[model samples]
Target: MIRSTRILGLAPRVAAARATALWPQLYHERVVDHYNNPRNVGSFDKNDPGVGTGLVGAPACGDVMKLQIKVDDQTGKIVDACFKTFGCGSAIASSSVATEWVKGKQMEEVLSIKNTEIAKHLSLPPVKLHCSMLAEDAIKAAVKDYEAKRAKLSPSKQRGSGGLINFIGDKAAIV
Candidate 1:
């Protein structure tokens, strides 16, 4: 009986040690490191032909996300991306990941990218899942802005129709 009691106590101690060691991996890091800080956090003059800007938010969680891209209109390629995010660390991380993923990508390529991929890259917790969703929406919004510009330059063409379809293709599709 003494041996059994000693074993039981030792097991809990071992378990606690393991839990402590894994805590950082399991919990969301609350602070945004400089690298993870959302950069380009404000609007530029998107009226310029090559600029694309997107703004989005979730009222339920009180999270707001904005993303922008500068594209080479001739090549249909993204030349740069920037983001500003308001929320927890996870939101910041998601925006950071989204900006990295969108920059230098072809417009078509950015469309294929997924929120789950951003979440996976950041190792986001489930409770922060909405943050990833916001990132994805922001990307799509920026792309729509780019496509809209493309359409405006050649108003007689259907250049942005597919993108317009994509705009309303998801759960949070903004009209």
Candidate 2:
């Protein structure tokens, strides 16, 4: 017959099993598996001539995101989009999904993507809204970069016309 101490010896194993069973229930939430194992989470050094880069952050949420887009200059169509994010799971998922959604999209069409769409795509919680905001800002920043560079090479600018001298700022372009 097992003594009380012997019975206590089995208590730990029983508790562990119970904890394991309850883990899924306790942690029930919608999370993006792919973002948890994010792919293409870095830079492309040798992109095409018409590619642009964007970096945006939210100090309040302590999240930073960088988005890069390769586009057909003449058609304003995005051939590729990629992202890097530093934050929680939701932030990473937001950036990841945003990149996928923006790729193969025309500039005008890409503009239609909103932060709410990214949040919905990731099924983010209300507390993680900053993640979607970062994605949205990054897209706008990338487009602005592409447009600025294109403007610099335009024929009108080649005539030494320096009217307002508008400029687009990317990560490095930031002062």
Candidate 3:
């Protein structure tokens, strides 16, 4: 009976020590912060003309991310960004940082954001680099979606001669 009680007491201590030792190895401070209090942790209306949505996943890790952007048509700037990520702390942090980086930036500028920057910012480990890549890909995908939607609404035509023409008001150009 004494041996049993001693074993029970040591079990909790061993577990606590293991967890404390592994915690830092598992996630960085920024990753933990973002996972606990993620920014822009919601979705936008995908059907809204001014909004674009991108959903991407890492098949190896089963990490899924949905990112959205609302653009101002006149300036072609991202007025707002949001995201929903279902993955590890690194993935969540990567997406949260992505939304913050994109807001208030022009579409062209947002495209320049690189995964390496995000990974560096988060101090992500080599194994978790794919999380940052996922965020970068999500941003590009959302921008492409927005552009495609806008193109469908614009006055554009395809000529039988394999040429494309765009008509804006009274002006037309073929390329």
The lDDT per prediction is 0.75, 0.73, 0.88
Q: Against the true structure, whose TM-score is highest?
A: 3
lDDT (10s digit) by residue, model 3, range 1-175: 4346344456867867876678667888888778778999999999988998889999999999999999999999899999999998899999999999999999889999999999999899999999999999999999988877776676464342433466666787764
- lDDT of model 2 at position 50: 86
TM-score of 2: 0.70
Residue pair clashes in candidate 3: none
Error of 2 at 138 (Å): 0.4
Q: 1 or 3: which has the higher lDDT?
A: 3
Looking at candidate 1, the ten consecutive residues that score lowest on lDDT are 166-175
In the range 89-113, model 1's lDDT, one tens digit per residue, is: 7787788878878878898899888
Model 2 lDDT tens row, 47-117: 44587788999988788898989897667788878888888777787788878888888887877889998
Best lDDT among the predictions, by candidate number: 3
RMSD (Å) per prediction? 11.0, 8.7, 4.8
TM-scores vs. true structure, each candidate: 0.70, 0.70, 0.81
Q: lDDT (0-100) at residue 26 of candidate 1?
A: 60
How does residue 9 of candidate 3 score in lDDT? 57
